[model samples]
Target: MQDFREAYQSTAVEVQENDIQDNEVELASPWQRIGAVLINSLITMVLYVPLFVGTAMMGDSNGESGVMWIGISAVLLLAWGIYQAILMSKTGQSLGKKLLGIKVVTLEGDNPGFVGTVLLREIVYNIILTVLGMIPFLGVLISIGAAIALLVMIFLDGNNRRTLQDMLAKTLVVKA
Candidate 1:
C-alpha cells in the first residue's frame, strides 16, 4: 500500500507539472517580433520629426516657439499614447502586432485591457525610459545595458522568448 501511494503521488506531480507547461501558448517567431518593433519605430519617428521641426522652426527669438514645441510635443505624445493603449488593451494588437499577425495576451489568453496591460504594463515602462533618457551619460549607459539585457533575456529564456518588458507586463506575445 505504501508503494502504491508513492507511485500515485509521483504521477500526480508529473501531471500537474505537465499541465502548467502546456498552459504556456506558443510564442510568436522572433522575426515577427522584430518586424513589429521596426514598424512601430518608423511610425514613431514619422510622427515625431515633422512636429518637432515644424514647431521649432515656427518659434521666434522670444522662445515662444520653444514653448509651443514643448506643448505640441506633449499633446502629440499623449495622443499617440492613447492610441496605442486603447488598441493594445482592447484588441491585444498594436498596429505592428496586427500587421505581423501576432497578439499580446494575458497568461490565461485574455485581453488585459488598457489600464492593466497598456497603461500599467507597457506605458509605465515607456515613461520610465523617457525620464531616464533625459539624464546625461548615465542615461545612455543604462539604455545600452537595457538593450543588451533585453536581447539576452529574449534569446536565453528557456521557457519563453520573453523580453524584460514582456515579463514585467505579465503578457505574452503569440502568433495569431
Candidate 2:
C-alpha cells in the first residue's frame, strides 16, 4: 500500500480549465421548465379565449354547425402554432421562457435553428400526440404514458436537464 501510494504521488497530473465568459450558461431546473410551460399555456389559452367563446356561442346541436366550429378552431390553432414556431425559431425563447430568463440552445450551447426548435421540438411531438389522440381508449392510455415518460426523463436527466423534446432536437434549456 505504501509503495502504491508513493508511485501514485510521484505521477504528475494536469487539469484543464474551461474558458469562462460573460455568457456562461446554466442548466434550467425542471421547475423552471414546468413553470414556463404553464405560463405559456396560459398565454395561449388567453389568445384563444375569444375564438373559443365565439365558437361556443355559435355552435349548435346540429352536426352542420359543428363542422364550422371545428373549422374555425382548427384555423385558430394553426395560427397560434405558427406564431409560437416563429418566436422560438428567432429567439430560442418563448414568451414564458424569455420572461423567466431561460432559453433553448443546441447541445453544444448554440442557438437551435428553426428546424431544430420548431420542427423537431414542437411540431413532431405534437403530430404524434394528435395522431394518437385520434385513436380510442388505447390512444389515451398511450398518450398519458408518453407524458409520464417525458416527465420522468426531465427529472432524471441530472445536470443535463433535458426533456424529451430537448432530446429529440438535441437542444437544452438553459439560463440566459
Candidate 3:
C-alpha cells in the first residue's frame, strides 16, 4: 500500500507539471495589440481604395453608378470579413495579428475557432457599437467612449491582458 501511494503521488506531480507547461503562454503586450489594430485598420482602408477610385472616376450623376459602387464595396467588404474569419478560426491570427507575431487563443492555448473569433469577438461587439452609434445626439459619443473603455481594459488587465472582446470570447492575445 505504501509503494502504491508513492507511485500515485509521483504520477500526479508529473501530470501537474505537464499541464502547467502545456497551458503556459506569453501574453501580447498592449503596444503589440495596438499595433496590430492599426495595421488591420490600414489594410481595411487600403481594401476600399478601389471603391473610392471607382466612385471618383464615375461621378454618379444619375445615382445609378453610385448604386453599383455601393454593391461592389459591399462585396469587397464581405470578402475581407470572410478572409479574416477564416484565418482567425484556423490559426487564431488575422492578417494584422499574423504580421505582428501575435495570435488569439483560447484559455487552454488552442485556436479560438469560428464562434469565438467571428461571433463573440467580432460580430457581437460590432453590433453593439453600431447600435450605440445609431442612437440620438449622444450616440456617436457613447460609441467612441465604449471603444476607448475597451482599449483601456487591455492596459488595466495586467495579469491576463484581456480586452472586453477577449473576455467575452474567452480568448487571449498572445505572442506567437
Candidate 4:
C-alpha cells in the first residue's frame, strides 16, 4: 500500500511537469467531454428540482406566474453558478470536465477575476443564452443560432473541443 501511494504521487508530479514541458495546451478527448457534460447536467437537474417546482407553483395552464418565475429562475442560476464555481475550484474541473479529463485554465485575462474558466465559459455564456431565449419568436431563432455557433466552434477547434465560449474565454478542455 505504501509503495503504491508513492507511485501514484510520483506519476502525478511527472504528468504536471510534462504539461509545462510541452509548451502548448494538452486537451482531453471528445468522449470525456460528453461524459462530463452529462454528469454536470444530472447534478444540476437535481439541484434545480425544487426551483422547478417553485416556478411551476407560480404558474398553471394559464401561463407563468410572472415575476415569481423570473425570481425563481434567477435564484436557480445563482445557485448553479456558485455550485459550478466551487466544484471547478476543488477539482479543477466540473463533473463533466472530470469525466472528460479536462481542466479549465485561463489562456487570456481573468478579466472578471473569477477562478475556474468554467465559471465564465460555462456559467456566464449560459446566462447570455438564457437572456436571449426570453425574447419573442426572434429569441428562439437567436437561441438556435447561438447554440449552433457554439457547436461549430467546438467542431472547428484543434481537437474537436473548445466551444465558442471556451475560445472566447481563452480556456481549454484538457486531460486531467
Residue 110 C-alpha lDDT in model 1:
67
Q: List the residue pairs that clash in candidate 3.
A: none
TM-score-better candidate, 1 vs 3: 3
Worst 10 residues of 1 by lDDT: 13-22
Q: Candidate 3 lDDT, tens digit per residue, 138-160?
A: 89899889889878877874537
Q: After superposition, how far is residue 167 of candidate 2 from its true place, in Å?
A: 1.5
**Model 2 segments more than 4 A misplaced:** 1-24, 59-80
lDDT of 2 by residue, 70-133 (tens): 6776787788778777889998988788888888987666788798888889989789877987
Give the number of colliding residue pairs in candidate 3: 0
lDDT of each: 0.74, 0.74, 0.81, 0.65
- Candidate 4 lDDT tens digits, 1-176: 99999999899856654554365655565566667778887877776665676566656663455446656767877877787777776656765776566776644312223544655676778888899899988899999998777555555544336676765565666665
Candidate 2 vs candidate 4, lDDT winner: 2
What TM-score would you give candidate 3 relative to the actual structure?
A: 0.77
Per-residue alpha-carbon lDDT of candidate 1 for residues 138-172, written as tens digits (9 for 90 to 100): 89887888788776765654746767677677666
Q: Give me the runs in candidate 1 sitting further than 4 Å from their true place.
A: 1-24, 59-78, 130-137
lDDT of 2: 0.74
> Sorted on TM-score, highest at the top, how do the candidates line up?
3, 2, 1, 4
Per-candidate clashes come to 1, 0, 0, 4
Error in Å for residue 4 of model 2: 36
